[model samples]
Target: MTPLIEADGLGRSYQQAGEAVVALSPASLRIWPSQRIALVGRSGSGKSTLLHLLAGLDQPSCGKLAWPTLGPVESLLPEKVALVFQAPSLLDSLSVAENVALPLLMAGQGRDSAARVAFALKTFGLLALVDKLPQTLSGGQMQCVAMARAIVGQPKLILADEPTGQLDQLSAQALLDALFRHLADSECALLIATHDPVIAARMDIHWHMEHGLLSCGERTAGSV
Candidate 1:
């Protein structure tokens, strides 16, 4: 079977002060459907760079990245793939339910299709805040809403970048449980970038980044 995503010698760089600055060195990895991967690295270690490349938010400075089975990279987002950024980028003008339902709407889902939106809110424990705006919610609540939005479309893959960074330990754990449970039920692949060892421990595959280098392998026991 074709991999969900494949990167062949993928890398990214930028020109800083007329000199080339390497943000990520050429790295290769194949992400299969329904696979769970954790990307761990310190700040500026190229974790975000790699995530952006994989999400097709930014093109790699060199080499190639492809979604062999999904066809065009642009066509995959918000449908075949979803991205949850580090910060909750919810549309403030919309209510919680609207925010969660936005992706589906953008993907051509009709407004009459509220069942998917309702399910996502209830699953993420955001049902109570459905009518509320983002500004009125707590940081944890906003994060929950973001996750709800990401999964509402039932995308084949989710690319999350430090999704739980703003929450307390307890809330983070709860959110992670909900995320994994959603993925399990939907059979969706997840590639998450995180700094927490506990979060990394739960993933099946580990991608470690350091000084622009990326190395990936299956998680070893007690390696967290």
Candidate 2:
């Protein structure tokens, strides 16, 4: 099977008040098409740093990331890759449906944007609230709207950074279940950063980062 994403010796660092902080250590990783990989780690463990790199939202300071790395890479397309933030990133200024259609519009998409937005809203059971403002929804409902926004573009890769962190247990589980089920039926691959072992245990594989170093299998020893 072709690995949809590959990071070879990928590294990232930041300058915080003139002090260098190593956000991600040089690490190699791969995920095949339709693969669901969980990333578990404690706070400050570099999970979010890695998710950013994988999603092509940010580039590595050193090393390389190849798209469709495992096989048949035809072309590298932008927006075909997506990132889901921990918080509901919906625009309070736009209605839920309009918020969901932003990416498509940004990509210069046309009339079908409305249809695609409706489909995404239906998937997350947010169709009834399509005309509501983001600020009016409950936390879980807000996040559902955010998710509908993420998947409405037909992305091939989805990178989630503790997407359920702000959600209640029931809501978190429901969203995760829906996301994984989507991956199973579609050709997309997901790499998620999370603290929930209940969700991690259901993953195809997992990676734990510690002090900017990538560790496979079990989490950083003694991690929560």
Best by lDDT: 1
Candidate 2 yields a Cα-based lDDT of: 0.78
How close is every model to the real structure, measured as TM-score?
A: 0.95, 0.88
> Against the true structure, whose TM-score is highest?
1
In angstroms, how far off is 40's CA in candidate 1? 0.2
Runs in model 1 deviating more than 4 A are none
Report lDDT per candidate: 0.87, 0.78
- RMSD of each candidate? 1.3, 3.2
Candidate 2: tens digits of C-alpha lDDT, residues 1-224: 77777779999999999998999989988777777778887889899888777766677898988876523332323357777887668788999989889888877785789888998888777789989988888877877777787788888887877777778888888887777666667888877888988777667777877788887663333343
* Model 1 C-alpha lDDT per residue in residues 81-139, reported as the tens digit of each score: 89888866989999998888888888898566489999998887878899999999988
Note the clash tally of each candidate.
0, 0
